[model samples]
Target: MVRLPLTPAEVARGQRLGALLRRARGERSMLDIALDAHVSPETLRKIESGRVATPAFPTIAAIADVLGLSLDAVWAEISRPEHDVTPAASAHTRPERLTA
Candidate 1:
């Protein structure tokens, strides 16, 4: 079956997902994480580079589990609109004081 092309939003989301995973990986080697996730290093690299934009759910779950990331949080982060601020970004912003 021929797969339909992904929308630009979907591509951006995939890139965001890859960025989040890479950040969470910190100093760990790609090979180590891939081995722990039970996926080939090449597969992990592809996912990390956003080359495989729509990876299988099981593969994502496995990687998330290995990385100790909350799948729900990952979904929430990646699902937000491009113009919206992420929780992480918002958290670092200064709060406004209420003037009575």
Candidate 2:
């Protein structure tokens, strides 16, 4: 099977996901959490570091379960559109065009 390169948006999303997971992890040791989630510590480390940008669904599910995070919440958090500026903010700033 062939894998395609990830877009910048995907990379950003992965970073956000990793940050969320790290915060949710609190003071728990990565090894303990990984063991509880039935995954290798290295895998968890990679996920937390955003090295495994798009992890397998099962792996994410397992980690979410161990961390007591709802899949819906996780999806909502990660799937939010990246808004560079609010409507009011955008009104104040001039839009710039890029020339190749």
Give each model's whole-structure lDDT: 0.77, 0.74
Native-referenced Cα lDDT, model 1: 0.77
Give residue 11's lDDT in candidate 2 (0 to 100): 86
Cα lDDT tens digits, model 1, 1-100, are 9989999988988888888788778899999999999999999998889888888888888887788776765676678889976644431122342111
Candidate 2 lDDT over residue span 28-84, tens digit each: 999999999999999999988989889988888788778877666566566767773
Segments in model 2 whose C-alpha atoms lie over 4 Å from true places: 84-100
On a 0 to 100 scale, what is the lDDT of residue 23 in model 1?
Answer: 78
The TM-scores of all predictions, comma-separated, are 0.83, 0.79
Off by over 4 Å in 1: 85-100
Best by lDDT: 1
Question: What is the lDDT for 6 in model 1?
Answer: 96
- Top TM-score hit: 1
